[model samples]
Target: METGTLYIIGTPIGNLEDITPRAIRILNEVDVVFCEDTRVTRRLFERHGITTHLKSLNARTESLKIAEVLDLLKEGQSVAYVSDAGTPTVSDPGSQLVGSVRNEGIKIEVIPGPSALTAALSITGVPASEFLFLGFLPHKKGRQTQLKEIAQTKRTVVLYESTHRIIKLLNELEEHIGERKVCIARELTKIYEEVLCGTPLELRGILENDPQKQKGEFVVVISQ
Candidate 1:
């Protein structure tokens, strides 16, 4: 019997319209859809009228669930994996699952969709021929070291940050990079989409003054 295929589907980060036609077809046809959050995926499914079976696959229980997924694939059940938003395995938990399936000789396919990092970079007017995606920085032990590395990188650096910690990370960048040009993209592709560009210190002041602006996820782009 042939092994099943694993589809890494990328859902919209903010707006539902960002999903492609092919992605919608795959989501509806797949045997099962594994998502980080069932409720969140349910909303997307409901909007598209897709009634495919849903399963929870997140970092917390990925290890325990991998065996079950592998078994299903071995039985020739096709599966589609999607993160709560954006692409999976890009700061998401689908990497291990994908790797495990591949190691078992199962096929894997990526269904690319809206990504905050790529979307923000495209509109920032910044050169992205060479770039580094740092995802979310470490919170504690190696946080300073990671920031230092980002500061020294020659290529453009992109990072994902929570609204709550954006100010703190900006302060750290100001101290480490010192006057580097930065772009902060928030609520990307959504109704409140915003892109603020300036020196680290300048952006810091803007964010501080408008507390309401810091209510959504952020993508920080730093130019070398």
Candidate 2:
């Protein structure tokens, strides 16, 4: 029996309109959509008029729920996995599922769409052909070592930062990475979206003054 395809789909990070038509079509046709948050993904599907059944496959449940995915694929069912925002497996869930699917020799495909990493890069004006993506820096242990590494690198660096830790990250960057050309993209593609460009000290000062600007997810670019 021929195995079915497992699609790792990339959804929008903010604005729903950013999603591709191809991604929409796949989501509509897939037998099931496994995602980080059913509530979040459902809104996207609803906006696109997609009615595919959604199954929860977040970090907590992915290991236990992945069997359902593998079983469906073995039965020749097409499956799609999406995160709450952006692409799956990039600072998101689905790594384990993808690894397991590959081990089973099941067909896996990527429907590339919106990603915070690319979104920030396109507007950062840093213009680097190559850059190291750290995803999210460690919250505790090994964090300082990684910061040191970032400080020393001559290449562009990109990473995600949460709203709560945005200030902390900027301070750490100031301490370790020193002053460099930093671009902070907040709430990309949304109504409140804005990008701030400056050195770590400059950006940190700006953020500290305007408490409102510190809100929302951030994609930071530190130019070489």
Candidate 3:
């Protein structure tokens, strides 16, 4: 009997229309889906009228439930994993599960879809032929060191930030990275989606006054 495949699928970051037909098909076909938020995933499933079994597998539940997932895969049952948004294991859970499956010789496949990283870069035109993606920066400890490192890198830098700390991060960038050209994209693929281009300080000012601009997810890019 053939071992089942592990599908690391990508879902839309915000816009439901961004979901690919292939991703939809895989969701319907998989025996089970391990997702970060069952409620969020349910909306997507309902949109497409899919009823695949969903099991919560976030940071809290992953360690406890991964053994069960591995058992199912070992039983020759194909399984799918998706984060609440974007691709699994990209600043999300599933890294440990993927690593474990790989070690066990299970077949793993990636079903690509919308990513804030790629979406922001697509519009920035910031000479990112070579760049480093730091995902989300550390929240507290060692945050300054990482900011310093981002400032010094010759290549472009890309990372994600939440609404609560977007302004704070831009302020930190102004102090650490100085007048480097920056692009800040928020609410990608949504009605209110907007991208701001300027120095870190300028972007900080824009986000500070406009409470609406600071309401959604953010992707920040800094030029070399």
lDDT of each: 0.92, 0.92, 0.91
Candidate 2, position 190, lDDT: 95
Q: Which stretches of candidate 3 lie over 4 Å from their true place?
A: none
Model 2 gets an lDDT of 0.92
Q: Model 1, range 56-171, lDDT digits (tens) per residue?
A: 99999898899989998898988999999999998899888988998988999998998888999999988899999899998898999888898789999999999889999999
Estimate, for each residue in 1-224, the C-alpha lDDT of model 2 and write its tens digit: 88899999998898989888889999989899898988998899889899999989999998998898999999999999999999899998899999999999999999998889998999889966999999899999999999999999999999899999999999999898776889999999999999999988999899999999999999999999
Off by over 4 Å in 2: none
lDDT of 2 at 120: 94
The alpha-carbon deviation from the true structure for residue 165 of candidate 3, after best TM-score superposition, in angstroms, is 0.6
Q: Which is the leading candidate under lDDT?
A: 2
Scanning candidate 1 in windows of ten residues, the lowest lDDT window is 144-153
The TM-score measured for candidate 1 stands at 0.98
User: If ranked by lDDT, best first, what sequence of candidates would result?
Assistant: 2, 1, 3
Sort by TM-score, best first: what order? 1, 2, 3
Clashing residue pairs, backbone N/CA/C < 3 A, model 3: none
